[model samples]
Target: MKKIISIYILLSFSFAYPVTLNELIDLAEKNSPVLKEKALDIKIKEVKKKQIHKKKFGEIHLFGSFNRFEDPRILYPITPPIDPRNLVGAKNQFITGISYSVPIFTGFEIEKNTEISILAKRVKEIEYLLTKNQLIYNIKSIYLKILSLQKQKKALISYKQSLIELYKNIQESVKVGKKPEVDLLKVDYQIESVEAEIEKVKNSIYALKSALKTIIGKKDINLSVIEDVRLTELDNFNRTQLLKNINSLDTLKQATLSEEISEKKVKIAQGKYLPKIYFTASAQRNMGNSEYKDLWQVGFIVEYTFFDFGRRKHEYIQSKLELKKAKLQKKTLRLKIIQKIDEALSEIKTAISKIKASEKQLLFAKEVEKIEKAKYEEGVSDLYDYLLAKSQRFLAESSYYQAIYEKESAISYLQYILEEFKNE
Candidate 1:
């Protein structure tokens, strides 16, 4: 049993060192599955753009055909002064050729499509940044919470020790008949309660560390302990400055790209209403049992859809509506961004106020606990009053820490909304 206890103690301390915040953030970036997926999306958009651009160069084909006719005929068309000898005929015929066909005109559809693909790629890039910003924000928030909980655990441990000392003193008093037996029981109960609270804090810390491990993609990394996080103060911002810079936000940029893509779709629909022109060139060798001929031709083909069952018109209308919808979405996102920034700023102010209030509360609670401790020692106060004062002090300390971390969290959220991680 002693050996088992020794091994347990060794194992517990092995992973007790704190991992730095920057190191964790870097690990998350390097190993995040979601970020990798977004990167692949950008590459796909790039390939799509290339594919559309390649269409402008047209395509070439090598074609062949064989046939056995019912009757003898000329191997291929021949133009002459009706020379019967030269017009040889055969039943078996074969033709092989190379043809090149290119679109001479399609109302600029290829160009518009290429533009849309470029915009889509840009949108993907913006999405990647947005994902990264949110991810970092989440990591920071969790890290701060863990630090806060760790501090609370320390306070709880200290509180428990004080209670234990009081329980011992009360036991001595009860033996001497200087205090009632119930006072000893009361102190013992307070100690038990503090122990329970300490266990609760330990369980919370374990759960948070497990979640942090998943986020960084290093489930095996030792996060059994974490150091306190220090928050860097952010610069002040007013409505005017934030609004002026809102145009550069990634969400808005993605919306703009969507609007542009929709506009291109409308143009593509309009292109369908116009005539299409194609240029074709081919060279072929025609063979028969007794005749061999070589022919080459170059021509232009014009195709116009003079009628459709209002399909083109309906598509054009749909595209227009989609474009309108995208515009409205962009407008909505802009308003949301403004509102979020305002709310974040207000939260920061509220947190600062709480921090100040909690600081004073903690100071007063400490004084009260000190006075109660002295009075209890002098037999002028009851155990209940002393324990209550200590509990109040512990709670005040917890609240102060909570307020500070909340302010930091609010600042992190504001930075995420502004997409400030790009600069980092």
Candidate 2:
């Protein structure tokens, strides 16, 4: 454990590229196009929720029309002996009225609407969080790759230095008739091969950084050196507890409210068949082009739709189907969430085992290289054997970093599963 901590400190001092997880998550949220669009949707839904919050409000309607003498208000006579009461005027009719109408009863549109509004909000929120989780995964994955590359690079450089010293000793021995020239050539070839590999890995690291910059929305972000980082060394996290807190993803219960609302919409459609009670109290000033006079009228309307093709039936069936669809979708999401959790847990177990194995391999390689160095100088080992041991150590070191990266990536998967990435 101390060795691990020391490795982190050494890397931090050598290369101070410090970007915390929180900063990465913030950058992603601030710059993501998808999250921004989801935010807009949330705002629009919120506005709708606020506007329709009042279940019952009076309806104020006003209308005016401009007409020529060709079509006058009195052009057509009223109904039943052309009574004035039956005539709806069309000449500059400026009729304004406030009709006070309470739900008196809606097929329950108010209740359904309230539930749907809340569910809509949840859906948008989940979309935003899902965006956040994806961003976190992308950023952290890239970040881990960068660190892994740096660790491998450092190990290669260290191994190269060790081989340089050992080769010089071997050369001195060969000149003194203690070692073979062939062994010297072998060391040179080993050095060249390892150097090529290091270059290839460096290119890979560069590509990973480029991908990360694009995700962060940087036009031209330069990647500097990244220090080795050991993530929080905490006790084993509770997957159960984490998933329990992630129940927000299960907004299906709330989504089902839409079905309830649809049920209410069906009632509302049926209500269209029942008589509606509306109180209409209005004061209007009537005027004509010739000697205009003011006339005031007030009344209440008890209106009912007497006959229509099966329009109400169509509306009820459409609403019922919509409700059924929402319920089915909610159920599907529940199963999806469980599958996601199971996959993450499997990855986590694999990563943990890999990390443990990497730790032992790294330790063994270090000891092997140290022994080979001492032996080569004492003429107990040939130059070729010495260089091979050095290269092997570097390989082991790189593998250690690969294991570290895999561990972090697995943890990221778990975080996504549990929705802790939103906190990031």
Best by lDDT: 1
Runs in model 1 lying further than 4 Å from the true structure: 1-17, 88-92, 233-236, 288-292
lDDT of 2 at 219: 44
Q: In model 1, what is the error at residue 30, expressed in angstroms?
A: 1.3
RMSD of 1: 2.6
**Model 1 Cα shift for residue 92 (angstroms):** 4.2
Query: What local lDDT does model 2 show for residue 28?
Result: 67
lDDT of 2 by residue, 1-424 (tens): 9999999989866776666655655776788666788789889888878766775565655544334544546523234665666454445433332323344444445555766677677667766766777778878878887887888877887776766776787788889998788877887777787788779878988888888877877645435654455674542766677567655653444455555656666666655666766555544444334323344445556666676688877887887787788778777877777777777777777777877887898798889877987887687876566667777777777887787777777777777666666666
Q: Write the per-residue lDDT of candidate 1 for residues 272-347, one digit (tens) a residue.
A: 9989999999999999995689999999999999889999999999999999999999999999999999999988
TM-scores, in order shown? 0.91, 0.71
Candidate 2 has a TM-score of: 0.71
Q: Which ranges in model 2 have alpha carbons more than 4 Å from their true place?
A: 1-17, 26-35, 54-62, 70-106, 163-189, 217-289, 296-315, 366-387
lDDT for each candidate structure = 0.88, 0.68
> What C-alpha lDDT does candidate 2 achieve relative to the native structure?
0.68
